[model samples]
Target: MSYDAKVFNVMVASPGDVLAERALFREVIHEWNAVNSEVRKVVLMPVGWETHSSPEMGAGPQEIINQQVLHSCDLLVGIFWTRAGTPTTEYASGTIEEIEKHIAAGRLAMLYFSTTPAVLDDVDNEQYQTLRDFKASCRSRGLFESFDSLAEFRNKFSRQLQQKLNAHEMFKLTQTESSSNQPVSDFMRLTVPSLTHEAKVLLKEVSQDPHGRLTYVRYIGGAAMQSNAKSFLDSKERREVAKWENALQLLQEEELIVERGHKGEFFEITAKGYEVADTIIS
Candidate 1:
């Protein structure tokens, strides 16, 4: 089967009221696009503009950009600088609505980054409170990522993106390693202990026959030793019979012993069984 390269669309949401946050968002998207060809699209919401030349465009330029940004992207990246004044109520409304739309469409993954209030001048007590509210909102919706600084954000974003991309490759490698053949000795070493414990339990049950040696084998056969009934020894044991029977079937299917026509069947261990038994005893 052929695989197609996947394209990632990123949308950045920032408190447009803060110049520093707007600048940072722009810089990050620009740098990300330059480095990762897979990230085919990047859209920034209202807080993205630096300065507007035309006042005639009307007062709702930010709202218009917010709507456009939401419509264009698949993933939303929220940059939270608590010190930056809370996004205007209008910005918050637009973001919340966009988030709902993305969720309904099953097309959204969200990441959040928070910056220290002390680092930005406009970030005040009221702004911090607004950020706390925003953080709480994100937590309730289970949409968040956190960073201590811009540098941290850069590092973490790259790491997360790489992990998302390489996950399938890693899984495929694990499957390949598991399927490659291994030596019988290696298989024996891994399987013997558990097999020995199981054999001991089965042998113990066989040894418990109240009849003579010939009748003992007969009892085992009558109990359908070839079936899963070996686990029916106790009150709660019936449920586990199928599991025991499956294990027993593996041993029988390997021809570990020959069954002579039902004159009280006798078990003469095969060469394979003798080798396995000797290994267990030693």
Candidate 2:
């Protein structure tokens, strides 16, 4: 019943305005650990100033936090809404400071900005500008995700986290490789590069249909994959049609979808398929 696992500590960095999103990060991390820690032999420990650090003297408050919490984090998840965080002496805000230090240390980082509407009067003018500037600066460094709702945020984070761990060159395993001989390609099927936009479009549409089924029918002019009157096989040209049909094959190979009929005319999305769809769609 007992086992050993590598623990990856994650720091949740954000301003006070995104309190709901901050809590959501903790829930997602815990849920990931609960579902995947055993299978993957990795545990994600959520670390933040609130839960990870204790009071100490002899340093600036942010410095104390840096020593106590930020320095130890392996992955940094930064979320921003309206305002930037409270500024420290050396940086625009404590959250930014944490994010910068984490990146400087060569750790993996996932940053997100929320687009959900904010109250007109509550928006802090100066800090909002600061947040916008910071977000703009991030465009050059790498890609960051944006969400318009809490549900969207949850879906994106959960899905991307799977992408991160499924082929984890981002966070090198802290512990030495176990004798278990996991594999040369651990969950490589779920890697981002493998899912084309065509595949994503199909997965998203099929996951929402009744019984999660994708039906294949060959007509006089063309063949089609359909569900709820919507079509996945949208192309009639040979190459374009191959591309769309290949998306169906890739989904099946990943076990995100299963063939339900003997003639391979009906494909059904599995529970795993739905989870993967949730990650990719929203």
Candidate 3:
């Protein structure tokens, strides 16, 4: 019952208005996996905060959701309609924050803004304006598509998903060829990027947490991590703070840790991160 197929987690991020689009997204992803998984040797798993996260407290609610769900996504699909989504401290809405974070990681983020006309009374002028601004921002950031109906979105998504799979296959092939040509030592170096001492120290500190979570902003303060993180950090150079920040970003990119607080102020040790740190500590 064990098959070796590469699994890609696709995060579907959206606001309240796009209920139909969200449902269609799940259907499309299911179809993709069913049709393409066997032949392609890959499966696309759809992920979203609503399904992935349970109730938790500590940082802002949205931040916690991000840490749990957003960090693990291999690809992000953002859908927007009349609603721009509720405001957050950092971005106009949580969806925006999620999409931006995913894109900032130098990964793929596909945004679909609905252009279908709506009744004047049903639309919130302010919310629509915010959505417009975000759509414009998307144009500057990357290419985005629009659909007038759910049917259209479904068709477009299927084509796009196929293209993505094709690209993934090419990338794997390239990596395989490149690795084959490189020396063992060179391949090892290329595969494993060295983790900085500060990053290791921070990971070590978080690894000690009984609850397996840390307040993102508070961790910057000495008291949050107690003498453990502080002691190690204090022994380092004057740029320790910057090093810590860099470590967090690196851990994030490596999918070793997840952040949950607004403006990325909360973090927790992901299972993968914990395993790595456990090995190091042992």
Candidate 4:
């Protein structure tokens, strides 16, 4: 098939220590492409110093990389595990320089710090300390993320990538045009949660009812709650049960659900409740 795809160059920046993460970058890009390429008609290409061929000397290594790769990326994904990397002429480290440069140009970057336990013997105290200092400086420079393991990093990055795509005007426009001729989705008007875990679970439970109603007693008692439910509202503790009661009342006041009967023995999911549930289930 002959087609044009919007191509975005993503620079993967890191020191020598995060080799596993560096590889994960490529895997994530490929995973994203597999799902998004045909649907979104967008291609994200990952670039790094290891993948680029430049003269051994002339300008500094980082400078050569800046000219050949980093400057051209549409997005930057920087990772740090232990080392802050080797110093450069104009900056403390090449990775830091790349990040600052990207930020200065008003581009996008996602910096991640791995908190997974490391062996004391394998760590260089000076470099680890430098990484910590660099992290502190980054607070005002741009937004960053912390991950405990590769699995968490993958999950977080996937969400972040989708969010970035949604926020891009061109991507939004493409999606609009693509679906303009189709019927609206059931999830078209859905509003995602701004409620507590307990409230969300209660709301979703009511939504799943065949008649759009649930017994108030069953709701608070945690009847048929999901295995992954996080709330402790069903516990015998009076304080926790009261918390769930408060959430239930709040939902009623918001018109997402309605309390029926003189004794408030039943609750019915409203149109608003269904809308919110679609956001979670879809």
Candidate 5:
């Protein structure tokens, strides 16, 4: 089946704290990709170093890897497992940094999978506290997803992911329809505190100029409202101009048109704009 290229990019970040949880994440990605042929590939970043080369690196290698992963991703998935003591080999500073960065960038759609805290007691005591802290942080950010077992985690993760994807697709469809059918008059009705309806209509017309800048002098005989306003001031005429201007603004905001001159006065729609317009109108 054909798919849209606008598939969301998800980033998985689970340091070694939960080794079993990795499989659940991988399965979700695999299922999502299989069903959504248009989605590129789901990328899974490594959580820990395969082999320790030097402590002197000070998490630099992991940091670099995390940066690369975060740069290309649109969402984050974090897995949490409770242990009595933090595992000395598991908590990589770089992994935490990646999560922080993702949150900062406003692209963090985090889901947490938590295991029993009792099972963690056999591990490092201090490390267990660290894990608790991590869980608390996830709770604060509203990123926590609790699971009693691996199977439970798998089921919940898949359900949540599907929900997110569906919501996004629905939103895109809504925007596409609105932008296509919206009349210019609807947009002209928006009141800019200082601008009159006539002035708003004039501004809307000038904003739609394919040349980017309004040549009112050329189009309106050197007066902003003298030409077009005189010819089209009837309610019907005003509505038509409003509809056209609304369409133009939508196209421009979507980057279908590039305004080049100072103050974006001059403009030309890109080839994509024409295609979109055709799709909408035809």
Candidate 6:
């Protein structure tokens, strides 16, 4: 018997900074295909400029990439962290140009912004500001997802893949059990609420601590959140202190960190917190 499967090209569009995270995006797709492709009669092929684009010189670099791969993209995933990308003749960056061209052609696009803190000294001021502006503009156009940790990124991508297949007509999933022989996944924490970037960073930092603790100490004129041999609070400024304080509170609210002794003073990372921290340590 012969079978048919529809293969959709998933174009990965991002600047150079997020190369590490970019691979994770493709890994998720490969996992999904391994699990459901045969049953669903659909396949997702991950495509990117790094893997697909070739050397040629007729037009600009971005234009060449567009002609080579962007024209045929079935789905566009635009990821941003520090740099927006090198500017083109028309758009903010090469990645943005790919996204704009793909979307303008009536294709689906998924955009994500990474919240992992970047060293301010190393970041290019112009490019970084451009990325911020684009991130803000993106909200007005359509739906998008934000993530702070690699662990959270993987989970969100998996969940989003499932939801998209179920919703999109081109890749509509066959109505059936995900797998009959396999047991339910304990790792499916889809119900787990998302975390703010600040909270996630603090959680990671604390997880790296020898005691795995997040402590808030109030002094005569200042307060600070200390963990992993570092202090987040630098000055006696109220605004800076409040932001770190809120991050501590958020980690507690999410149950990722539990109070070790006194409330608000000593909170240790939970088992689940370590699980997440492991994936994002690099």
TM-score of 3: 0.60
lDDT of 4 at 27: 77
Measured on C-alpha atoms, candidate 6 has an lDDT of 0.77
Quantify all predictions' global Cα lDDT against the true fold.
Answer: 0.44, 0.80, 0.72, 0.73, 0.49, 0.77
Per-residue lDDT of candidate 2, residues 103-188 (tens digit): 89998999999999999898999999999999999999998999987766765676677678765674445322642365535544
Worst 10 residues of 3 by lDDT: 219-228
| Model 6 TM-score relative to the real fold | 0.61
Model 4 global lDDT (CA atoms, 0 to 1): 0.73
For every model shown, the clashing-pair count is 3, 0, 2, 0, 19, 0
Q: Over the stretch 1-282, how does candidate 4's per-residue lDDT look in tens digits?
A: 664567889889999988888887887678667645755567889889888746777787788899888888888999999999998999889999998898898888889999999999999999999899999998986678998876567546655666677687746776776566455555442334377777777777666544455554444535322212233344766677777777787778767776655767666655445556656642
Collision pairs in model 2: none
Specify the highest-lDDT model's number: 2
**Per-residue lDDT over 1-282 for candidate 3, one digit per residue giving the tens place of the 0 to 100 score:** 454566778999999999999998998788666544544456788999889998998899789988899988888999999988988989999999998888888778888988888999999999999999988877766688888877567656755666665566533664465446554554344433457876777776766654445554443334222213444344334466567667778878866667656766666655446545655642
Ranking by lDDT: 2, 6, 4, 3, 5, 1
**Tens-digit lDDT string for candidate 6 (1-282):** 454567889999999998877988988788667655655566889998888999998789899889888988898888888999999999988888898889889999999888989899989999999999888888889998888876656556655666687778656433333333334455443424477677778888877775566778787878767888888888777877787788777877766787766545877665456555655634
Instruction: Show model 5 residue runs off by greater than 4 Å.
Output: 1-4, 38-59, 83-92, 117-121, 168-282
lDDT of 5 by residue, 144-217 (tens): 67887665575567556655644565335744654455544543343112333443443444333332233222
Worst 10 residues of 5 by lDDT: 221-230
Q: Model 4: number of clashes?
A: 0
TM-score each candidate: 0.41, 0.68, 0.60, 0.64, 0.48, 0.61
Candidate 2 Cα deviation (angstroms), residue 237? 32
Alpha-carbon lDDT of model 3:
0.72
The candidate with the higher TM-score, 2 or 3, is 2
